[model samples]
Target chain A: MIKNKTGRIFEIIFYPLVSILIFLIIWDVGVKNSELSVVMPGPWEVVSKFIQSFAVPIGKYTMVYHILYSLMRVVPAYIVGSLAGIILGILMGWYPVINRILRPLYELIRPIPPIAWIPISIVWFGIGEGSKWFLIFLAAFVPITLNAYAGATTVDETLIKCSKMLGASDGQVFKTVVLPYSVPHIFTGLQVGLSTSWATVVAAEMIRSTEGVGWIIISSMDTNNVVQSLVGIMGIGVVGFILAIVMRKIEEVLCRWNRIET
Target chain B: MEQDRNLDIILKCENVSKKFQTKHRTKEVIGNINLEVRKNEFVVLFGPGQCGKTTMLNILSGLEKTTTGKVFLNDREVVEPGPDRGVVFQSISLYPWLTVMGNVEYGPKVRGINKKVRKEKAEYYIELVGLKGFENSYPNQISGGMKQRVGIARAYCNEPDVLFMDEPFSALDAQTRYLMQEEIMRIWEKEKRTVIFVTNNIEEALYLADRIILFTNCPTQIKKEYVIDLPRPRDYTSDDFLKLREEITENMAHTL
Candidate 1:
């Protein structure tokens, strides 16, 4: 097992590095021959810009500032929206009356894209962080709710019967059986929600915020600093990748008993 | 066999019937079935597929409600499922999220037993089932026969008045099933709870049961009852065992 794990780790590290090296060689050769460097900066230019931005620290306006600002808006909204969505979804799926009363409303609102609510959000809460937060909330909410509902509804009936036979009350059964069983699906939803939140954050920040990774890209685009814009874009991808890795680690720790299929 | 008849009745089913209504039709599954399980008795209900043996066992365990008649546990009418009747299903029904010890302790915890007491009870049963060192092992980490052992230990830990087994060893491989049968017999000998075992295996019924109740096909009714007079550690190759097996098989064939 140890030997296999070591071989796996070696493959994981070497495979990605080899791919990146090949891609960089192709990119550098292409940039030397064409005029595409003005529009799409090569990897070296983006890395240089990123390092220069890091070297300079201003008043809440560095690369770190934009990253933190984007995170602040996305994190709270993601938490609130996903948590509420999960709880409501479980209720809607578990009880007939709740499903009857809430399902139609959800179906109606879900079809309207989160971006479509931008105008209403601006009017209702103005062009401040509130509108951006609402957008992030909407982006995160729908998938979490749908996945949670599906997870709760599809719990194995035999497990519920077993729980009841063991003297678990209705609430206890829901807590122990329904909730835990739905976790893998719920985590799937959360991963989707997290990525969506990051995707939508750029749009939200561009629409309203004075500072964020999205704003940095827009400002760099306005000034025709394409390399800085590319830096901003790559930063977003890196942050998203980190978040995904963190979530996966958490899932592993919490669901140690669940056998993951390769 | 004599001791079983002499002991007080722990469970009684009086004219129990179960019917199910589907979208298109209503059908009776069991009809006017009556049974009594004396304390420490191992009674086997034997029949073929769709014989309502499972339905009857479910009704007795309060998992399925009887359309008519009643089930009594220690003279108290059973209306809902409770820990008083522990059930082992054909499938290994151990909670996937819980470890072997956790699965065993689930019943006691739900019944509001203290943590220490529940842990002790769970540990005792885990050891009883010869899974002493695998306390923290999850259900998925174990083999099929081991998982079934965990299920058996979990049910036994509750110390139920009557243990209801619904073809518990049917899913096991032939060799594992035979080994499990011996394990069950050993456990029964030691613990001596009233057990109502349901199976389609006639040889199994003959081997384990003090009394065997044979049922007819769908909308099942008890066709005959046989008192197994075989002694402990019954040899399957013995003349008396084979004779009983042949008689039961013939009876079942004739009913079919």
Candidate 2:
């Protein structure tokens, strides 16, 4: 078993390297032949620009500054939004009165895109970090809430009865039985929320921000420095990838029982 | 025989009936049944499918309400499920996310027992059920039989006045079921608690019970009650055992 696990890990590590190498080769070749302007520089150019910017001062349109700015807005919004979503979702799912009172309002609001909230957010909070934070929160909240509600509502009745038979009170059963059982579904919501938060950060920054990766990309566009803009985009992808990997690792650790074959 | 009268009554069901109302019709599951389980006695209820055996057990455990009549636990009315009557369900209902120890400790914890005492109680029951080494293992990490052991241990840890088993071993394979019956018998001998076991298997009923209550099909009523006079460590091949099995089987065959 130990040997099999080791072999699996080795395969996982090597397979990604092979794929990345193939992707890079294709990208390099395609960029060399394409008539697309320097505005859309190739993968290699973006990498070199990323390295060159890092050689300069820390806050001078560098990869670190833009990435940190984006993270600052996205992380807090994601945390607050997801926490609210989970609490509300569990309540809505567990109590019929809450579900009946809140579900229609949720449905009405959920259809409005997070980006579409820009004008209202700007009017409410002005074009500062708050507007961007609100957009990111809006993006992360709906899916997490909906998924959590579905998870909590569908808990097995047999399990609940089993808990009661063993002398668990309603509160005890909800805490030890229902909550833990709904974790996989909650984690699924978190994964969606995390990814969507990242997707919305750029749009949020594009609408209202002055110092995030999205703002940096916009400034690069104004200056017609396509390579820098491409570097910013690549940096966003890499950061998102890293965040996803971290979330997956946490998911595996917390939900070892729910593991399934890929 | 005189000692039978000395035995305390742990559970009593007086004219218990259950009617489930569905959208289409109100079907009576159990019709006016009277039963009693004496303290430390291993009582088994046997019947074929849809015979309301499970419904009776559910009423005993306070998982379902009786449409008529009353159930008394140690002379008090059974209004809701409590730790005084621990139940081992047919489906191994150990909490999936909790480790074996966590599941075992759940009862005591909910009963307002302190952490140290609950842990000790859980540990004792874990060892009692022969699952000492797998305390930290989650439900999915264990086999079906092992999971059932955890379920049994969890119920036993609560130290209930009566242990209500709803076909606890019926889901297991034949060999495992037989082994679990012996295990349960051993545990019962040591614990000396009243047990109300429900099953559909005739052999299982014969093998385990001091008294076997057989039930008829839908709107189930007790058809016959047999007081087994067989000695302990009963041999299945013995003439007396065969004759008793035949009697019970013949009695059950006519129920449909």
What fraction of the correct interface contacts does each predicted structure contain? 0.61, 0.55
> What digit string (tens of lDDT, one per residue) describes model 2 on residues B1-256?
3364347777899999999999999999999999988888889999987789888988988888999999999999998888889889898877777789998998888878999999999999999989989998888888888989998998899899989899998789988998898899788777778889999888888888899999998889999999887877777788988999999889889988
- Model 2 residue B99 distance off true place after TM-score fit, in angstroms: 1.5
After superposition, the stretches of candidate 1 with alpha carbons farther than 4 Å from their true spots are A1-5, A30-38, A56-60, A260-262, B4-6
Error of 1 at A143 (Å): 1.2
Give each prediction's DockQ, rounded to 2 decimals: 0.57, 0.47
Q: How well is candidate 1 docked (DockQ)?
A: 0.57
Candidate 2 error regions (>4 Å): A4-9, A33-40, A56-60, A223-225, A260-262, B1-6
